[model samples]
Target chain A: MFGLMTGQKIDRIPVSPFAMGYAAKVCGFSIGDFYANAKVNFRSQLMAADMHGYDSSPMYGYASIGAWEFGGKIGFPYEVGHGAPYVIEHPVETPEDVDRLEIPDPSRAGSNPISMEVAKQCNALGLPAVFQVGGFITFAGNIMEPARMLLWMIRKPELVHKVISKVLAFQKLTADWYIDTFGPEKCMVFSGGATESNKLISAKQFETFTLPNEIAINKYVLDKGIHSVLMHPCADQNANIPHYRKIREECGWRGRYVWNFGPETPLEKQIEMFGAHDIIGGNVDPPSFQTKSFDEVIMLCKDNIERGMKNPSGYILMPGCELPPLTPPINVHAMMTAARKFGSFE
Target chain B: MNEEILNGLADAVIAGDVEKAEKCAKDSISADMDAYTSIMEGCAKGMNVVSKKYECGETYVPEILCSAEAMNAAMDILKPHLKADATAVPKKIVLGVTKGDVHEIGKNLVKLMLEAAGFKVIDLGKDVPTEKFVAAVKEEDADICALSALMTTSMIFMPDVIREVKRVKPSIVTMVGGGPLSAATAETYGADGYAKDASVAVKVAKDLVRSV
Candidate 1:
């Protein structure tokens, strides 16, 4: 079981690129169809993942929906290549507004509930399922208005902390539910979003606001005897492995974890630095899945497999970020074919 | 403001202190200094330093937006005095988050920099309908409309906005910029120009406005 959870040895280093709404696009289904018909969506994802010999499958849930369901008016326009939905209208306007915010019912309101139900279905079907939990910082950033959040972080630091407290409370409520129902250790994996890519915020700001929350979540999840994967898909070329190591150590988690590496990530270097405990996944450019030929996809996946095999103890092959929405199914298949050919069960 | 005071303003901006920024600007103005020079030379100059810090990854959005608000407040006091001197407006541009897209960091940064450069910016808030953009163009009698969309899906709305603008006023130059947008994609969408960042957007907007 080459999964973020379980921490089991693999039959071979597996290929698992996150299907970020790409399943819908590749299957030519509407969002309504994708969400409404979980069985159909599940079949397509299983087919795509298996075609690639992928270790696991992923399904789409709106990143902003958790916050949006909690009274934030977030939305995504139906279109080609929108990627993920983001907050459009903020529900909270004043410091007093935090008083009015009610924790959203994850079983009812937004895609979180839909995703949870689907997770349950997937689990019952004996499919490995990863529940996408909002990163403490990113979710906090999304719930409040981005512009206003920025303003409030400075103009009202105390208020920002208060809002973050509420976000954490709500997030924990949902996370606790998932863990209790699914049994954290057996549930495929729990992934969270603390995108400390230096592109969006400074390393200092990341250290201050992002890292603490990430560390908190890591402890919370790991304390439950579950694994936590930190997704930092920011476009910061300057980010190094030492910071990641520091985060992992500071989080006090001795178990295995995965880092969602992106284009700028030096996988070999990171392997050298944090390979002892951290498993590096992704670095395949998402757009390449759309723009490249099947041969190119095969070569890319082969290269990743070869690289991972160089240190099979510390690598997971996958796309750098969420797979682009327009990624071709053939490319995905080719990636799986290559992985099966070159992978080892070390 | 003296070098110490200017440094304080710089520190305030870096720390995102609006009140200290306002107080520093007022104190400098009361000290028999030219308001424009005090602003352009004092506060705006400090912000440019902060912007460099931001570029170098020394500051984040919270700090930057707060600093921008400080600059905005200081500018409010200094704008009237500059108007008395018949100050030049670098460009007159209309800006908005494109229809169906609402992420505003890049757009807001572009607006901040444009305003910092003395452009009269008409900022239509997020989720702007195409008609609102067109109406703003006609009403503001704007020279350029700068559109932004953070998501690739919402980037489709940029072209619709350009078409709406051209359909009503063919001569109006429309510039689109965002994470998902590139010059090639912008050309594919029939945009007049594209910028990858705020400074680039400022330059493009200035050039487009000047040429138009």
Candidate 2:
């Protein structure tokens, strides 16, 4: 993956099989422990990575991270067929509640400490300590339920902005703690934007609510001498690309990143709009892992590799999002098999 | 004067103005307009336009939600004046986010549209179990049971709920929708209908009611 990132010649393209609960499900571990216990999540992901031979490392995070981190409650997966952890009650209910919120210590809040344990495990193995400061707007929504906050975009936008600012503060505090614990060179930042999908919110809302904080996060992370920053802009984000283009001038972009796309943004269009110089990955429909057979999975993966190999910078293959927990095991391996068989330059 | 009041109510809803919608509804009652026509012709008519605009990508969730609020506001003001015939034999539908999923945006949108279209929606809220759905169906004598799940892991439970509901009462229709599901998946699960989004869900439900 580093070889592809730095423009080095490689034997074949790398594959990042985005696994979370599928890791625990395959490794004979409990899904609840995977999210609640840091050691379990790291080990489960590492075991899955080893088994799949995918070019990735274990990272401790989940989509529902911010809710628990910011003084809310969540329920971790306890049984098979249950999804990832989810927030039970948002901390902020009414507009008045936003003023009453406070930022907790990153060292002790929610899973931040457990996340550090995963980072320690990574650092011990000579891998980068990855910190999850992704999803500012997602966290904001988690603090005050997504639907309520989304309505506030029209009804009470000031409340939404207030929550976002508080979230931004918490994010920076978390980043500062990670950088101090492990130097920037050894730390990788993982950020995502599932809530900002055009399916839910308009691109205009994305620019107003999510774009500035993301720009702030990128600048803060990159200026710290941290070279690695990979983003999985999940779901319908084709409309959000122009704002991304706008940030280059605002942030003095030191762009050497491989932006991951989903089924919404076609591989060709991302390459066309973002340019042919940076490493690009993904657009593999994630549900295919469960719904399609092995042969079908390979055909879909081979198509991704063939079209993705065109850009000069390079290509890596990955699931459009985290694989569904019960996705067939054979399909997980099919991505690597396709990469090995069809991704080679020779 | 009746046409003028009804048009005013529809225009307020289409414009997504809660204040105007309330005023229009109150004016319809002051002029003694039929309550059922005000809802079906005025408020629902405006929601239909909003749904079509959303289908064409001209508007989005924020605007759509506001429109729903405007229509709901008008309905609340006009509901008590409704005649016995308009309230008679409204079909009941039990809706929920299937167990293990907490996401409710999709389900909530569908519920709003269903209620606006005159269906008696029995909302079971999030992370609902299969047995609970069957119980609701039997308890309410529901005509349809709609299930939603946002994640693939949780989505696996859809067929279980569908099968159980059918075993208990073979005549009840089952509907499913969410991020991971398709029409093929719904059919495979023995669901009578599948809607990709909330707007389409209304049409599918109406069709399912007619077919049954």
Candidate 3:
């Protein structure tokens, strides 16, 4: 993965499959156990990485961990098949809630201790840990009503900024802690799930509200000597891709990076837009991963690999986002097989 | 002068200025302009411009949201003046995110666009149960039911919700959308229509209503 990101030649295409939920199934653990217990999370991640020959292990836990730490109500399911937990109550309801908000200490907050422990375990196992943290906009959405937050961006710009500032502070602290403990070289910061799709927010709004904080968090990791900043924006974020170039320029980011495009973004367009970057990760339709046949999945993977290789940038075979928790294992195997057969650099 | 006021009302909505929208609405009423005329020619017309800009990638969520707010403010002033017959019949829509999914931005945007297109929308909010969708449809006599889900986990609930709605009233058109859904999935789940985004949703809802 590092070799691909640094413009060095590698024998084959790097494949770091973002299989969080599928990993749990591989280790005979439930999604609930996988998320709540650090040991189980680490074991499943390692087992899945080894089984699939994944290049890196993703350290993604419950999406609402940070929000839960800061006073949001998160509900975890007990049974394995019941699916992942969700936020039942948001911490912020009104503009005044922004003023009342305080950053949670990363060392002791809700699930951060457990998550950090999992990262430590991964590093101890010699597995490269990609510490995935939620972006400011997504974390804010988790802690507050998402639609109200977007409206607040227009009606109460100051209040929105106030909330975002607090979230960014917490994000920076979390990133710093990971860098301090795991060391910058072994760690990659996946600051993602901004959820600010072009369909949802305009380029102007993205530039004004979302871009600054993205730059801040990415810059924080870069300054600490972390070269790989993996950005995962879900859904159709084709419009937001150009803004990332601006982010690269403003932050003076010279390090390796991965840009994961959503399904709506065609591979040709992704190559046209970001082919000059270090690593281009995706464009696979997540729904198809759940519904398509194994042969179909392999065909899709081959098509994407062929088109993605057309650009000089190193390509990683990954889902557009996290694989659907119920995605069939055969399809994932087919993806790796396709990558190896067609993605040989030699 | 009346035409100028109506144009100003549309311009206010396009600019997303709530106060300006309200003022122009009041001026239209005082000038004996038909409230429906003001809404169609002024507020909705302005929203049309916003929608165009949105489609052309010239505008985004925040601007569309502010414009929705501006249109609502104008509607508040003009609604009281509209004759009972003129306002009595607009197609009604029941909208919500599926159970276990708290994502509401997509649902809310669809609601806003549907309203701007002159539909009466009843938003059931996020994490709504399948039964609630059935209840809303039966009670509101809705012409369409729109379901949204952002997670793959939550998307499984969509087929159940669609089934419950069909059981209650097979006549009511059902539409589904969100981050993880595609038109094929929507068809597989038995939805009448699917839209990738809010702008397309409005047109889909209208077409669904007409087809029904």
Candidate 4:
């Protein structure tokens, strides 16, 4: 039976919705063993999730190279526990570089199949999983020269727009393909884009350069009548409460903005600011969880949940960013337990 | 010009009101006020206010950039008049985002602070390749070349940029900064200087130029 809740529909709000490699490691498995065998990885993560009372379980934490599978030579460690995938080599260097890069045929080449496989495994387990999708700018930008990407925004705005349009088309196409393959009603699409945050580019820049692509993607999903969630993980120094509010106002398409702490975003305040939204996720410091004891982790999770989960407005207990691969499994479970025990605000 | 025009110019620039800024600058010049005074005294003061607002978290990136744009417009109005024999208060530095890194907030901040502190900065913008950086140093005949990268993957290319600069002209001071960089890391990468913050970057630029 699905555990039921009133304040928000989540019967048991997901706890530790981050990379699961650390969980597998803490549960006593090798990294190679976990990646190769989803069952082992899933078992460890589910054990932690269930013990912690998590309603939903996370799949791989850092499959950033999902975009690189298109043709970019992404540096591997493929999942640096949960950090952004490193670009060992870029596929696009010049205008001609874009020519060499083809939007990866997801079902065929990269981690796309692995993700679908994991989703199926979760479905078979009678649990729900969110399919994570990467955005065009960060993925494509990373593969191209970084500085050039910014200049491209300035000098070759048209070219950058062309590439971004192509990338977004791929993202939407891939998401649709996943839904059609996996059955849309059974699957929820979780979209991610960090570059759209105000840290790297101004709101003007975001509006001019990033927002169009974002709007297009969100529109694509919304047009399908599918619930598409957006996770914008930016810790820009200029990222503040009002800016967060503005982004949500501008880009919120019945989905939510998953936030991270930055120089400007105080962890406690972010929870207060985002409490009104039904889909706010994060603010726990992963490093703290990695280093702290279960009790401290419990306290941290409890504090964030109390503030962040005031009313179901959909709360996801997660780290502010990538859950460092070294985080303790007990700590993660404790976080989940706290969320389960105390996420109600009726 | 009255305080209204001067203050308006400053406020318009800080507010990123380009039209109002241009109007204010032109009004003051037509009123027989020196364009350099309007710029250094009015526009610079406005920029300082915006920077302070930024420091206090009152403004975000869009606002800061808009303010920078307003200031830039004022600069455009005043540069022609001030171009004559402008004495270098501090040595000129060339700045850019490193190869493969498009993150530019920190780099832009450094550029503003360096200019505020009286150093001429030739910003090459973000994601600059090694060749462009090398060319910038030679073209500007800059005394220092500053580089920045936000991602660890891209920051790895910072050393290569520095290497190319040294290869072209080893005498040019090569500096690097960003979230992923550490002082130890900068030294390891053969950079002459490392700064963690924009204000500190200005001081470092001044110090590097002085020593050079």
Candidate 5:
């Protein structure tokens, strides 16, 4: 993974399936247990990494720790095994509510302590850990209603900024704590889900509301010498890739980030647009991976890999987003096999 | 003069200005304009423009939501003035995010679009069970059942909801959408129709109602 990120020749392409709940199920734990128990989260991730023969283990299973601590009601449904906990209640309703919000301590907040322990455990195993944080826009959306957040962006820009500032501060503190405790080398991968994709927010709104905070969070990790900052944007964001050039021009982002294109964004277009960057991953059809045959999975992986390799930057074999829980394991193996056979460097 | 009022109302909705929309709606009512014409031409026209911009990628969710809010504000003013028989006979829609899915934004957008297109929508909100869909269809005498699921896990429940709805009210057209769904998946789940987004959802719902 490091070799691929650095534009160095590798023995073969690094294929890491972004499996969360699916991984937990493989380790024989219910989704409810996985979210509540640090041991279960860690074991599941490790075992799933081993089973999938992936390049690395993700440090966090659930991404709602911060929101949960901020008083959002998180629910672990019994039937949705290993699926992400849904926010049953939002904490902030009005602009004034943003002022009342408090940032929870990373060492003591809801699920944060458990997730931190998981990171420590992953580090002790000499595994490179990918610590996931919800992006400020997503965190803000989680704490408040998404529509209300967007309206506040227009009606009360200052309140939105005030809340997002707190979110960013909390994120920085959490990142620093992880870097301090787990050691930056042992926890080399840092990712944030900017799921508030351009598909939902206009490019102008993204520039006004999302870009500054995104830059701050990414810069914080980069300053700590973490080179790989995966920006996971959900849904079709094909129209918004040009906005990244604005980030490069304004924020001085020099191609250290990897862009995870959502499934709807065509791979050929992604390769044509973003393959010149340091690292660009994804564009696999997640629905097909979950339902299609192993041969189809192999064909999908091979096609993506072949297209992704056309750029000199780097490519990682993976799904457009996290693999759905119950995605066929044989299909995952097919992805790996395809990477091994066709992704070899010249 | 009523045409001017209707035009102003549509412009307010297109601009997503709630206060202006309300003011124009009041002006049309005071002018004794037909309430149906005010709603269809003024509010729905604005939403139609917004939907077109959304389809072309010139606008997005937040903007469409703002426009929806403006349309709703105007509708609140014009609804009472609508003739009893005219308002009573519109097609009904039952909309919700399916059970196990808490994502409401997408579902809410579809509701707004459907309402703007002149349908009466009964929203069941998020995490709606299969039984609730069937109940809503039977209770409301809905012509369309629109379900949304953003997660793969939640989408698995769509077929169950569709099956139950079909069993109870075979005449009700079932449609499914969200980030994870494709037309093929919607078909595989036995959905009568599939829409890729809210803009397309309005057209699909209209077509389904017309077919029925």
Candidate 6:
């Protein structure tokens, strides 16, 4: 994984199934435990990585973090169709609530304690620990209803900015705690940004709302000696490419950063937009693992790997998002199958 | 005066100015203009421009939402005045995000756009159980049943929901939308229709309603 992160010429390009709850279910563990239980989250992912022979580390967080962490209800994955924990009720429902909101102390926040416990496990075992700082825009939405956040952008820009600043502080301070505890080399900052995508806002709005926090967090972690960042710019963000370019110019570590794109933006376009230095991570449609047959999935993986292999810095073959919790193992195996067959440099 | 007020109302919705839209709606009422004309000519026309901007990538989700608020504000003023004989509700759709998927940003946008296009929508809300969707279809006698799912995980339930809806009422058109869905996937799931975005959803709903 480090070899892939450092852009070395390894024998084969690494494959990550991008499993979360899928990993838990794969290992006969409860999907709900994957989120609320630290040991379960770590052990399930570790076992799944070992079982599938995929080349990624077990991760410890979910995209829907802020609402729960900042004082709201969060639902664990108890149902067959649930992939990750979701915000059941946002902390700040009304504009008035925004004024009263407080950023929980990092050491005792909603799920940070669980997150820290998971990181400690990874650190003691010499594993690549993922420290999650969900993108500011998405986190802001997690704290409040997303539609309310967007409407606030027009009617109450100041209120929106207020929540964003508080959330941004929570993210940065949480990063500080992780880095202070485990040091940067042991932790790879993983950013998942669903709301930052153009699906919710335009590129200009992205520049206004998401870019500053992105640039700040990248620079912050880099300054503290973190060697890697895996940024999942979730959903269709073809239009936000131009604004994303600014982060590259300002933060300065193209090779160390891996930008994962979904099917919304073509892989080739992402490669070109990201340039020749940063590692690019995906393009495989996650839905295929549930819908397509094994051979069909292998074919898709091969197509993605071949396109990604052409990237100058490096490429990692993985699904664009978390695999469906019920994704078939044969289809999951197809990813490694394609990686071994077509991704070999030997 | 009615022409000027109608045009101004369109401008307010397009601008996403809720206060102005309400004022325009009130002005139309004071003028004693046809309330149906105020909706068909005023607010919906403005929503049309907002949808076009979305297609061109000139607008964002918040803009559409703000526009919806403006239109709905005007609607609150104009709806009661719509003469029963003149107001012919286009079609009714039962819409919600699929079970186990709580994300409803996409579903909400589609509902608003469907309303803008004059469809009477019965929103079932997010994380809706499959049985609830089927029940809604039967109870409302909905022309179309739309399901949304943001995760590959929850999207697996779509085909089953579609199947059950069809099993319960074969005449109802089933449609699906979300981040992970596509036109092909929709067909593969046996959906009668699909739309990639809210604006396109409005267009798709129109065609599906006509077919029904």
lDDT of each: 0.67, 0.85, 0.80, 0.64, 0.77, 0.86
What value does the lDDT take at residue A287 in candidate 4? 52
Worst 10 residues of 6 chain B by lDDT: B83-92
TM-score of each: 0.82, 0.97, 0.90, 0.60, 0.94, 0.97
* Candidate 4 lDDT by residue in tens digits, A87-204: 5556667887665667666666455566677777887875554566545556556656454566566556776777776677667767777678666555556655555445445556
Better of 5 and 6 by TM-score: 6
User: Which candidate do you rate higher for lDDT, 4 or 5?
Assistant: 5
- In model 6 chain A, which range of ten residues has the least summed lDDT? A246-255
lDDT (10s digit) by residue, model 6, range B1-212:
88999999999999999999999999999999999999989999999889888878888888888888899999999999988899765688999988888888889888888888788999999888889999999998888999988888788788899999888889999888888888888999899889887878988888887787
**Tens digit per residue, CA lDDT, model 5, A187-264:** 554444434677678777777777787767666776786655666666666666675545544545554667676877
Which parts of model 2 are misplaced by more than 4 Å? none
Off by over 4 Å in 5: A2-9, A61-65, A245-256, A268-277
Model 2: per-residue Cα lDDT over B34-55, one tens digit each: 9999998899888888877777
> Any runs in candidate 4 off by more than 4 Å, and if so which?
A1-14, A28-44, A50-53, A61-67, A78-84, A99-101, A228-230, A237-277, A291-299, A333-346, B1-212
Candidate 4, lDDT over the whole model? 0.64
lDDT of 6 by residue, A1-346 (tens): 6787765668988888789878988899988998889999999988999998998887777888789889999998888778788888999988889989998899999888998888888888888667888488888988987888988987888898899889888888998898889888888888877888887798888888778878887787888888888888888888888777778788774438888876677878878877477888866998888888999999999999888888887888988887877889999899988999999988
Error of 3 at A139 (Å): 3.2
State the lDDT of candidate 3 residue by residue for A1-346, as single tens digits.
6678767878888776677767887778887777788888788877887888877664856555456867777776543223566677778997778889889887876677877888788788675556656466767767776677787888888887888888888877887888888889888777676457777776677778778888777777788888777877766777777877777876664788787867777877767766676578866787788888999999998998888878677788888877787888888888889888999977
Clash number for every model?
Answer: 2, 0, 0, 10, 1, 0
RMSD of each: 4.2, 1.6, 2.9, 8.9, 2.3, 1.6
Residue A153 lDDT (model 3): 84
- Those runs of model 3 whose alpha carbons end farther than 4 Å from true positions after fitting are A2-11, A25-28, A61-66, A77-85, A250-253, A268-277
Candidate 3 versus truth, CA RMSD in Å, comes to: 2.9
